[model samples]
Target: MDRTRTRTRYFTPSEVAAHNTTSDLWVSFLGKVFDLSPLVACFQGDPLLLPITECAGSDISSWFDPRTRDIRRFVDPQTNCIRYYTPRGRFIHTPPSGPRSDWDNDVGEPWWRNLQYQVGLLSEKTRWIRIVNTLTSQEQLQEVCSEETMEEILQRYLCYNSHARSYTWKFDGAILDMSATLMENGVPDDDQELDQLGLDRDTFIPAVLLHFNDDLTEG
Candidate 1:
């Protein structure tokens, strides 16, 4: 999912929610999404995997300390030593309590820290937009991450228009700032207001028209 070289990949919470099965598990923790299906398969039948499986398609940011970017810990009363406080039951990646000789020491990096398991960043916000091609009179309705810059959005639109980079992006007759995110470019996100007013979003999604620059750039 993070394969696009020119674009930064982002996933909405609902998008991550769709992969909530054991065979297609996805979880977001500390603002990053992880595809943990391989880990689930590797630790199949282990009770420790329960916490992760049960909370699939949800944020687990609470499990970590924001400052340290590590698991939250508490002082164990009996041992008087700090221990990871996983109220939902320990998961497969949790460090062993009171290290035992049997616990394998060669497990490599934890799933949360492994780049192989990371898919994308969790979108802070998402908005609907339409890309209208002036030359072809074509229109494509898109649900886009609000954090995307005009250039990144162009990268996303390449599937529809191979020469997207050769076009000028304009919203309301003003050339867009390619370096800034949609919000920073002054495209307001009014989804929340639309929801409050009970208005259908399809009719209100902003449109950005593309005018061909005729550079004849080749892929």
Candidate 2:
């Protein structure tokens, strides 16, 4: 385990997709998500950036070579030489088909190689949960990365209930361990199982009832 990645944030595909746009672009490749909005702003009107814009808020793993972890390359039959196989046309960081004297060689690291642009890891799995406030009778359905713990899930619920921490979280009448993940709390994600059984996973989102603790300590 890479201890450096112990607290890595995880995002669902839809969450990434929501950032689609030239002003707020996000894309994932090789399981890592990148915010390319800055790149878009840098190359604002460049036509070569179309391929990236076309795939904003989506995964572009196919654009890279698995082993190389770089743009896919192939022998260009016309040139009889290795070349970046950008059928969508060469985008940012891609060298010209043939070198030109004007091509700036000091562009620094490519966007993919620049770790500063890396936002988070794309979630391998996501699950939906229904959070109900026992005091207010308000319910909010939330989709969260399965990698998130109950404590993190509470943060998501905060958008619906501001004083979320004032509530005692429970499932099936048992208090939950805020530090534990859903599975650690014995919550099973059966989306695939439901699909295999011809049932809609959306129809069976498990509910976590929040019982308000009359802790006047919270303002």
For candidate 2, lDDT tens digit of each residue in 22-58? 9999999998999999999999999878999999999
> What lDDT tens digits, residue by residue, belong to model 1 across residues 160-187?
9898888888877778888777777777
List where candidate 1 sits over 4 angstroms from the true fold.
1-8, 99-101, 133-141, 155-168, 177-179, 190-204, 211-219
Best by TM-score: 2
Pairing residues by index, what is the TM-score of model 2? 0.90
Clashes of each: 0, 0
- Candidate 1: pairs in clash: none
**Runs off by more than 4 Å, candidate 2:** 1-6, 215-219
Candidate 2 at residue 64, lDDT? 95
TM-score, candidate number 1 = 0.74
